[model samples]
Target: MPVRVVDSSAPSQVSGANPSHTSPPACTLLSVGQAFSGTQNVSSLQKDEAWRVNVRIQGCDLDHGYLCGTMEALNVPMADTPWVIQVVTFWEGEIVDMKNYTFFTGKWEATVGKPFPLMVVLSIVNRSEVDTRHWTKFPSFSPLLSQVEVDGGRSLDLSNYPYIFMRWKEQYFVNVGTDCGLTIAGFYYVCFSCSDGSINGFYYDPNSSPFQKLELKITNEGRSGFSFSSYELQ
Candidate 1:
């Protein structure tokens, strides 16, 4: 697949989160992909309740799946938000909180020293079961990092921040309190603004603890636990 840079066109405000509770994820039909190795952990909420997640990909065939990238992790856990999707396109290594956007691929480009777009396919589930969600498309999105100044308009570098791990309390990882950063008056550029042009979920504090480390896991006898002993700075 040839890499192409997207134009300045704005992202179309589309629907998000499949509402059907029993439907399989969109990634299932991409390849002959079944649940490739997954890990389960006891929930921090219900003692008897457990959370299971899996990382599915087309192995060596990046050309096979609609959402082609290095990694695509998805799962349905009976939590506040029952469905979760994480996708990384060829150019962007990782996209945090992808569930927050209405679909905004037009925001990234290699011309700006960033990664280019790739063959994209999204079979996303609907409706977040969370009490408070960051899915608001426009005006309500957070702007925490978009306000930062870059030399000659460089694309944001997500590698410097910690990756979002759904295994934790979910809240602590994706939640950046409304007051965590500054918001430019007219620009509505705040610390947690989702206006980063990718998805509606880019708001964050760079130096914050939750954004400091990647998720670590250990597997044994069909169970995986957060490996607290392992953490590497992004």
Candidate 2:
């Protein structure tokens, strides 16, 4: 699916100070949301509802910037072959004021089974300042089957059970199982801070808006394995 951007501007509000000779704002290196694109197809095993996400960058000095995020659904039908669903980085738009900068946002969906789970990742970089800090939060996925492994010399039941793995920031990894699942389905608030080597700071505000809520569901798609049925964030 394509990338979507959300507008997060409120009544004129100010929070931080701007330094002399300010550099351009940071660029969004990556962003991934499970609730982007409304609803997406993952092979033919199962279908899942979409989640909602909103991202805002406040307290910075820059007029224009770039950002991108991607989400992938993995299905491992066999030890040697696997299926993947992915969304990558794309430009959202330009920023005019740091006090009221809300640029990136969207929703997405997917389908999966036992051998795989949903994975999301996001990354941002500030080019204007040597040091920077930003706050971000999105919905987390809970896997139906938590852990599995494949050995070359061992005989395994490949048809009855599948394996899944999710990686974020290329450092953290999560295993999906039958017990774990996403806990929420709404927007989260974050704070960002940046400065040259002489000055730097960061802040993150928890989501307090009344419109934030979570909804989740699981379905049996009648395939050889289980599948995600529906999900909504409103």
Q: Who wins the lDDT comparison?
A: 1
lDDT for residue 116 in candidate 2, whole number 0-100: 18
How well does candidate 1 score on lDDT at residue 224? 23
* Candidate 2 structure lDDT: 0.20
Q: How far in Å is the alpha carbon of 200 misplaced in model 1?
A: 17
Candidate 1 lDDT tens digits, 49-168: 222333222221212111211222233231244443332221111122223221222221201222212232322111121101222223432232231111111223232222221111
Residue-level error in angstroms, candidate 1, position 25 = 26
Candidate 2 total steric clashes: 32
Writing each residue's lDDT as its tens digit, candidate 2 over 34-137 gives: 12212222121233333332221111223322221222222222223353222221112222122222212211111111111113212212111111112122
